[model samples]
Target: MTYHRTRIRRRRAAALLAVLGAVAALIGHRSPPPIPSPTTLARQLTVAAGDHFHREPGSGALGTAGGALPDDASVFDDNYPGITRLDPDLLSALRRAATDAGAIRFVVNSGWRSPAYEDELRRQAVAKYGSEQEAARWVATGTTSAHVSGDAVDVGPTAADSWLAQHGAAYGLCQIYANEPWHYELRDGAATQGCPQMYADPTHDPRMQK
Candidate 1:
């Protein structure tokens, strides 16, 4: 009788081992989440930048009337002739971050600007602030402005800026100036290790010294 009981116990232990092994094998074969490749990101960027506006579901085509945007335009504001004026990579990054935050739109306060426009902005800053040095802290010259190169964007609606500040680095986008939470630029490897320390302001950036 004791021998029969031992045999039954061994069979039960063997069955348990088999079940555990199968479970482990199943887990090992499970696929990981897909990471976006650079090529894929580039393609997404192109598509996003090419579109002029994002309309709500059921909304009809939009047209500018009396120099005013439709009430439901995707972006809060834009100075460019078209959204494509912004850097594709930057737009791609912003889109990814916005999606993660459940934001409906990026709300661009500014995007690519012509050299003449940048220069004019600088001049206005100097006039209002009372010195070229003070203006330099707030606005870059035409030659040095990232906006003129289509590499930077100024996002608005304080909530969007706050979201970017906390999460932009995960998409290779980073706030460049400590004083300007709305400003962001693409920085290589920002997605993994994260962005570098921000300058206190543009004046503190070495790139602005020139």
Candidate 2:
């Protein structure tokens, strides 16, 4: 009888251990991986989206031109994001600057674009410019646009140009290219000194950049 009792106890202990192991495995499988920390996200934003290397001699030169995108992609002006959902600080500064400047209308040709949307833009730009490099200097790869990280904006109108040039540094907003008078970014000069990471892939949809 004592032997029988010892065997039964051992059997129950083994069963319990097995059950616990199974449960632990299930829990581990169900949980998704943790998102990168804020620090890492900030770093990614810096490099992925910053404007340091993207700078060129004559960006924004076509602000006065109708349709922000190349003629082919511009066919869908019906598509770009509205001015309201852009970076809070940049948006606010634009409002202030626009209001102060009086009649300085800022044209938000694009904002918070998705990677997929960027891809289409790239396609149209490549068609127009004949090369990705040329298109990149013309617009942006979704990954590199300050707008991808919600830190940049495209502005139109020459009146705001001189104003932003003088005050943009004060508010942390800077132009992506010298030619494009309308594009602007938050100073975050420290946030992306060497241009840490692109906000998203140039081919990414604005929605997915985040």
Candidate 3:
């Protein structure tokens, strides 16, 4: 009887070892997490206040007539016109979107604005809207303006804005204000997680409260 009991115990131990080995093999063969899509990877690119700004090479003259912009021209991307300086990351994302969409041209209605220019825009807004509080809804103050920070761009015409509205998030660009289809900013994780809910306007943006 003792011999019989030892044989049974050995058989049980061998079965247990086999089960453990099977489990280890199963784990080793498990698939890796899915790779992010190309659009998703593009969206992960960084946009920071300190990011460098770039202009098209040899852009020399500044006015609407259009040529290579002079180094002193207030804006970059003169090739398309009306664009001021743009954050490097933002520009890259915009170009990528344009390429993906097969857009012939992407016009920048507004980009990096100096504090003074923002202030002037604010003044115009106040004049048109009748109150600073009301103007704040559409135009941010110089200090709070995303344009001043080089993190925002106002793209146009209607077709471009429409394309961006639908596809910008894939490139990490999001329309920040519900009212401004032309405006977009870089939002973290927008590629994978998607963009945050938009405020109605600058006035409604919590960042503008400061």
Candidate 4:
């Protein structure tokens, strides 16, 4: 009976290990993603500058938008979550990128989620995740918005993100948020210090938006 119980315990241990291994592969918890070379991404984004640095580091898999990117009239290219008109040079850069890639049309995963939309998303996250702190860590909203400036963006991949980090200087696009890997900004190296400096004014925040 003792030997039988020991065998059962070993079987259970083996089962647990198998389950953990499967979970690791599903989430890619072991290794880092294969980021593209700086040259490859520069070709992809249609920009080439020597001094570049990405503020955001990762990509969101179809966060708010559906599956792959779509060239829908409702979703304008290079717009914010609100579909606000983007900076002219910014638009030209993105448009040129799509025309060159010949693979994926530049589509907005989200142009802008309005203040109301942001509040709702926050509420939903708090309800599901059990705390505002947890929710905010995952989704940003309102007063702490990057969408208001019409300068921020969340690209599709780290490879692309890495490319932007390496060569986005000439185009004026910079990753914006600190914790959110998908968020970025086109600061253009204004007299501002960073997003924190730019958003210090309530006027720049979405919750403060009219």
Candidate 5:
């Protein structure tokens, strides 16, 4: 009777071991997740890089001064002080122009600068050019800067600039300086009379004389 009981227990143990071994074999044969192709991996990396580089509206990258912008930014995103602080007329014109732009998108690089931001840029420009005189061609004094007055916008991407050059006069947005093709300002009556001739650079503008 003891030997029979022992034999029964051994059989049960063997059955349990066989079931566990079968489960292990099934798990080992299961398929793994597919690896992404090189192209897919590269595209994912590019998107991640773009997200890392870009700041959302009102992210406070430069404290409250807030002039930096991303490529996909809209003129209507007023969460940014740079967009809200723009001259009303200029902002209105930009909105209208944006609506009619079709495929072309305006990417604001800089707008509505604080005095501190303007001064810092001026200092950097002076250092880059090795003289205040040469720097004046690029950066303006805070007191006389159109950016400080909320009257100017710097837009970018070569395609956007070209599109603006062609259609901007109708919206009163004219490139202010030949040297700075990205810079634009609203010119009153530009729609009817056409835009005024662009200055060679900011140095040629009478406004900078002050």
Candidate 6:
């Protein structure tokens, strides 16, 4: 009876190991996305810049609508509605940060986004992630996205993000997500109280649920 029990335990352990091995193999087979080069990012920004004022056909919904930013976009560039439409306090803070940024230029990768533009992005995210639940980690619906409400901005290149991470609190701009280093929002008392803790991702944010 003892020998039989021992054999049963061994079989269970072997089955568990096989399952674990299969799971590991599946994970290992999934390829990570390629990191875009700086040039590629700049090109995408240029495309976004020119796409301003686009409208979604048949829906009467504004797509870019002057809300798409360019690679060389500055905080003070009000010509683009994207920059001009940001929450007034957040825009002010960004301008101040820009002046003091020095060699690290604060390039606005994205600012305000039209509901139509946001919806399109959400669709693309869902496609890329293979499900809305997984995509929610990166993109939110127009009603839930801070960008659509002009309360958030995505700054870049890598140097600018790093600079903002270090000195943004002084201007009340705070990174809200641990996963997106370039995304920032205005925190009213951050200049004095320091920034609050970051959410793991948008999926973890209470604001995203609504």
RMSD of candidate 1 to the truth, in angstroms, is: 17.5
User: TM-scores for all candidates?
Assistant: 0.62, 0.48, 0.62, 0.45, 0.69, 0.72
**Residue-wise lDDT of candidate 6 within 1-210, one digit each (tens)?**
999999999999999999999999998896889987534443353344335434233323443353655456777787777888898989988988988998777887788888777776777667755788876877788889999899999887888889999999999999998877889999988989999999988989999878
Angstrom error at residue 198, model 5? 1.0
**Highest TM-score model number:** 6
How far residue 68's Cα lies from its native spot in candidate 3, in Å, is: 16
* Ten-residue region with minimum lDDT total, candidate 3: 44-53
Give lDDT per model, in order: 0.65, 0.51, 0.65, 0.45, 0.75, 0.78
Runs in model 2 deviating more than 4 A are 1-81, 188-210
Global CA lDDT of candidate 3, please? 0.65
Which stretch of 10 consecutive residues in model 6 shows the poorest summed lDDT?
52-61
Encode model 5's per-residue lDDT on 1-210: one tens digit a residue.
999999999999999999999999998896889986533432233233224434444445343344544445577787666778999999999888877987777766677877766776677667756789977888898899999899998775568789889999999999998777778999999999989999988899999998
TM-score of 5: 0.69
lDDT of 2 at 87: 64
RMSD of candidates 1 onward, in order? 17.5, 16.6, 18.6, 13.6, 15.2, 9.3
Positional deviation of residue 16's Cα in model 2 after best superposition, in angstroms: 99
lDDT of 2 at 76: 17
Return the lDDT, model 6, position 173: 93
Candidate 1 regions off by >4 Å? 1-79
- Candidate 6 C-alpha RMSD relative to the actual structure: 9.3
> Which digits, one per residue and each the tens of the lDDT, describe model 1 over residues 1-210?
999999999999999999999999998896988976533432233233223222223322221211112322344235333235667887777767777778446666556656655675667667756788877767788788887677887675668877787888888989898766777899999989899998987889887777
Estimate candidate 6's alpha-carbon lDDT, on a 0 to 1 scale.
0.78
Question: Model 6 — TM-score against the truth?
Answer: 0.72
Better of 3 and 5 by lDDT: 5
In the range 55-152, model 2's lDDT, one tens digit per residue, is: 43332322211112321122113342334446677677666666666655555545555544455455666675567765555456566655555566
Cα shift from native, residue 158, model 2 (Å): 1.9
